[model samples]
Target chain A: MNLGSLLDFTYLSFIDACKHSLYPYLPKRRSIQSDRVHLEAAVSWLMKSIDKVDGNGSSKAYRILNGWMPPYPETSGYIIETLLNLQDHYGDGKFFQAASKIGDWEISIQLEHGGFVGREIGVLSRPVIFNTGMVLLGLNALFDRTREKRYLDAGIRAGQFLVECLDENGCFVRNLHDHLIHTYNVRAAWALIQLGLLSGSRDFIEAGRKNVEWSLGQQLENGYFLHNHFRKGQKALTHSIGYVMRGILEAYLLLGEKRYLDCLKKTADKFVAIYGIRRRLVSELDENWKEVSSHLCLTGYAQIALNLLKLFKITKEERYLNTALHLIDDVKLQQPLNRRSEYFGGIKGSFPVYGRYAPLQFPNWAAKFFIDALLLKIEVMRDYENSLIDKLSLGRQ
Target chain B: MQELAKHHEVFAVFGKKGIWDHLDTYLRRRNEIDVHRRHTLAPLLPASHNAHAFPGPVNTLRFLRRLGIPCYKVSHLNGAASVDLLKRLKPDYGIAAVDHMLLPAVIDCFPTLLNAHYGNLPQVKGRDATEWSILLHDHLNVCLHEIVERMDAGRIYLKENIAVDKGDDFEILRAKCQDAAKSLYLRFFERPEECKNLYESNEDGKNYYLMNWELKALAQKKVERR
Candidate 1:
C-alpha cells in the first residue's frame, strides 16, 4: 500500500473513532426494531413499489418520503422473481400480471446484443454482465410462469451472450460493470447454469461450472471471497457477499455438487461465527471476516438468512435455523407498518435510512430480496414444523 | 449421560466449529504468526487430514441431537448463540467442555458453568495444560472447575489426582487426563442435589500456550529416561 493509501486508512480510522465516541450521545431515530413484517405489509410494499416505477418499468424509489425516481433495471429484474414466487405461493393472478409486466419491461430494454444495461434511462446503455444476468433470471422465471416463447427466447439469447463472454476458465471476462472483476458474478453464472438446465444446453452448464470452479479458487481459507467488490482492497458490502453466497448455494442445489455445498457450509459457518446469535448484522465486512461497518444491509441480512435456512433444510442443524430465525425476525422488524406513505412496506438500503450503498433511499432490490427471505422463512418453518409433527405421529404409531 | 438423563433432562449440547475447521484455523494462524515477519510459520500439515476421513465433531453432535439433546453449532465456546440457546433451554446446570475459551457472557450467564480441566488446578490452568503438567511432572490432577472470565480461574468444583504411570509418554498422559475428566464428571453428577456452585476462588495459576517443540522433545526424553 502507498503512503497516500495508508494515510487514507488512518484518517478513516480516526473518523470512525470519533463516530463511536459520539454515537452514544446522539438520539437514535427511525429504529428498525419497530415491528415484524406481516405477509400483507410485505406484499403491499411490493405492489406499491412496482406502481411507483417510472416509464422504464422498474420500481422507483419513493424519494424524500414522497415522489418516485428513475426505475432501476438491476433491481427491477429481481423484483420480478420475487413477484412470480409470491404469485405461486399465494396463487394470486395480480402478482403474476405484475411480474409479467416487469419481465416484459426488462425484455424490452435488453440490448440488441442480448445483454442488459446497469441504468436503463440515464447511462450510455452499454452491456453489463451482472445486469444482463439479473434480467435473464427474470425472463427465465417469466417463461416458467407464462410458458411464453418470447420470454424463453430472450432468456436463451441472454444466456448465449454470457456464454460468449466466458473466457477459457469460465469467467465473464467481458462486460463487467467496471474494469474490476467481481467475485459475486457467481449469481450471473448461476443464472446461466439455470438457463443451461432449462434449455438443455450442455455448453451453457459447462460455462457456469467453470465460472464456479474459478470462484472456488478465489475463496479465502476462512471462507471469505477475494476481489468481491468494485474496490480492489476494501470492505465488501453484504450485498455483494450475499450475491456470491446465494449463487454458490443455488449452484449446489442445482448440481448437487458436494464440493460446492462444502464451500457454502464453510462460508456460512464464518458468518455464524461473526454475527453470533441474534446480534445485529452489519452492512460490510473486511477480508478477515470481521465487520468493518456497523450499518445494517437489509438485503444482505435477508439474503444470508435465506441461505442459512436452506442449509438448515439440507444439514438439519438446529444452529442454522436458530440464527436464521433471528435474522428473519430482525429484517421483518425493519418493514414499515401502518403508514400512509409508499415507504411503508419497502425495505431500505440501510437500517438507519442513512448509510453507504443508496443512502437514505429505498432501493427496489432491497424489497425484492426482503420478499424472497420472508417467503423462504415461511416455507422453511412450515417444513420444519411438519417434520416435528411427523416424528410425533411416528412415535405414537 | 444415561444417569443424568434419568435425573434431569440434558436439554442441550453445544459444539464449536467442527474439528476439521479447528485444524484448518490452527494451521492458518500458525502460518500467520511467525518468528520472522514473513508469514512462514506454516507447518507441514498431514495431507490426509479431512472432515470426511475424521468425522469426530459432526458424529458426536449428531448422536447428541439424536438423543433428544439440542446440539448447537457455535462459533466458539462463548459464542452468543450458545448463550441464547442455553437461555432457551434453561437447564439446571450449564457444562462447558468445548476447546474455545469461554466468553464473559457465557461465564456470567449461568453463574455456575461447570467445566472439567484435564490438569491440576492453580498449576495447569490454560492451554495444553496436560502436556505441560506431564512435562513439569506436576501432580496429574484432573480438577473440575467453573469456567470464568480468566481461563480456568473459576472456583473449583472437585479435584482428584491420578498417579502418572512410569512409562507415561505424551499420548499416555493425554489418555490418563481424559479418563480422569470423564471419571470426575461421573462422580460429581452422581448426586445432582449435592453438587452446588461453591463460589470459592483459587490461587492464581500460570497460563500455558503452545508448547515449544524442543521442550516437548525434552519432556519425551525425560519420560523415556525415567
Candidate 2:
C-alpha cells in the first residue's frame, strides 16, 4: 500500500480503537475493572513504543525516564501519565507525589523564554535541534496535564524558540551536512503542533503546517526523501522517513486539516511500499531483510515507525493499523524473551555494551522508547495492570 | 680523605628546564669557585654522556654519587649508555628521580638505592603523581621518600604537607612540591645522620589505585557531594 493509504488506515483504526476502549471507562460508567484494564494496557503500549529505541545510557528520552540527575520534560510526561493512571485506579497519592516531583524538576529547567537548554549531547557535550524539540514536546504534555500557567507559559516560550529556529521557508537548518532536512523538520513540526494545539496559538500551528508542506514538497518521485544535500541525492531510509511521517501526521492532527492528512498518508504509503509492511514488522531486521543485524541506529528507526503506526491508528487509518500490528507481531517474534518477559514490551535498539545488537540496555532514551511501546501496546490490548504487575514481578525475579 | 678524593667522585644530575636549569647554572658557578681554590670540581653535565641521547642512566648514576660517597663515573655512565651501566658503576648506593622503570632487585643489589617521589611517602606514590592528586582533590602533602624494595614504602627523608588552594592545578602544585624537595634535599644533605633518623614507619593501610572508570565514578561522586 502507498504511504498515504497506510497512514489513513492506521489513523482511523487508532481513533476507533481508542474511542472504543475509552467509551466504557467514561465517568458514571459501569464495568470499571474492564475500563481500567484497557486504559492501563493502552498506556503500557504507548510506553513500550518509545522504550525500544533507547541506546546505551544516553539520549534525551532515556534521561527523563531513568537518570539520577534532573529528569527531562519528555520523560516526565510519561511519568505523569503513569501516575495519573495509578491515581485514577488505586486512588493513591504516592503516584501523584512522584509525578509532582518530576513535574517540579521539569518546571525548574524551563528556560526563561520557555524551552530547555538542550542537554549536552552524549559525552561530547553539544546542543542540537532534535533534543530541543523533544524537550518542548515533553513540556507541552506537562502543561496539558497540570494546566499550570508556568508550564503553559514555558511551553509557549519553547514553542516560540522552536519557531525562531526555522528558516524563511519553515524548514529546519540543522544537520545540513547530512542533508537530513526532512528528519529534523518533522520533529520541529511535531513540537510546533503540540504548542499550537495546546496553547491555541495560530502562529505555532501555521509554523508546523508550513514545515509539513515544505517536507511534502521535498518528497521525491520515488517516495524517498532526499538525503545528503551536498551530493543532492535521494534514498529512502526508515529513520528519516519515519520522522517526516510523524511530523506530517502530527501537523494534520493539530490542525484537523484533510490536506495535511492526505499528504501524510501519501508519505506513509510510500514508506510502507519502499520498506514493505512485512519487512518493517521486525524490530531489528536488516536492510537486506536479514534478521541478524545488531546496530541501534536502524533499530531506533523501526521503533519510530511503530510509533508512526500508532499515530496512524489514532487518525483512523486501517492500512496503517494493520501495518502496525504486523510490525508489532514481527518485533514480538524477534524478541526471544517476549513470551515470558513483561519489561521488554517495547521496541529495542542495538546496545554495544550488552553484546546484543539493538540491545535493551539501561540508557535513558532506550528505556523511554521501551516504556512507550509497552504502554501503547497495553493500552490497545487492555492488559496494562497485569503487564505492569508482571513487569514488577519480573524485576524481583 | 685525600686518597678518597682521588678515588671517589660525586656528580649532580640536573634537567635543562625549570629550577633544575638554574641549579645547573649555579653548580657551574660552584665549579668555577672550586677551580679558583685549586680543587677539581666534578662534571656538571647531564647523566647522558652522548649529547644526542637521553641521559636517564647517567642521571641515575649522578644521583648515586650524591650520597656523600666517592665514586668514579663508569664507562657506560660516561656517555649515553644502556642498562649495562648498572654493572659498570657497581656503586655502594644508587638514587633515581623520575627514572622510567623501577630498578630490579638484582640492580638494587649493587647498591642501596633511593628515589625522590613527588607525593607523600605513604599516600600518593605512583606515576602521574600530581595529576592523581589534583583529581583526587587531596591536599598537597608531598614528600621525597627513599626508594627501596617496596616502591614508596622506602624511608622518608623529608615531607611537607602544603595546603592546596581551591584553584590550584597540577602544574602549580608540582612546582611547589619541587621547591619543597629542593629545600628538603639541602637540609637532608646538610646532616645525613639527622635526616636518616627522621624516617618514620610506613603503614600498609593506604591504597595504591590504578586509574579506571571506578576512579572516574568516585571523582564524580565527590563532585556531587560538594
Error of 2 at A29 (Å): 35
Report per-candidate DockQ: 0.02, 0.00
Recovered share of real interface contacts in candidate 2 = 0.00
Question: Candidate 1's residue-wise lDDT over A1-397, tens digit each?
Answer: 4565355335434554564344333222223342234566767876776776632456556553334577777778777888888888888888888888888788887889898887645765688888888888888778877789998899988988888888888777898877778889898889888888888889888888999999998898989898787665567777888888899998998898999999988888777655642145688788886778777888888888888888988998645665676676666655667576446777767765556666656667777777787788778766765665555457557
Q: Considering every candidate listed, which one attains the maximal lDDT?
A: 1
Ten contiguous residues minimizing lDDT sum, candidate 1 chain A: A26-35
For every candidate in turn, the CA RMSD to the true structure comes to: 19.6, 27.7
Predicted model with the maximum TM-score: 1
Q: Candidate 2 residues A106-150, lDDT tens each?
A: 566565655454443223223345555665665666677678787
Fraction of native A-B contacts kept, per candidate: 0.00, 0.00
TM per candidate: 0.62, 0.42
DockQ of 2: 0.00
Report the backbone clash tally of model 2. Answer: 90
What is the alpha-carbon RMSD of candidate 2 to the true structure? 27.7
In model 2, which runs have C-alpha deviations exceeding 4 angstroms? A1-99, A111-114, A119-127, A174-182, A227-237, A271-317, A333-347, A351-363, A370-397, B1-226
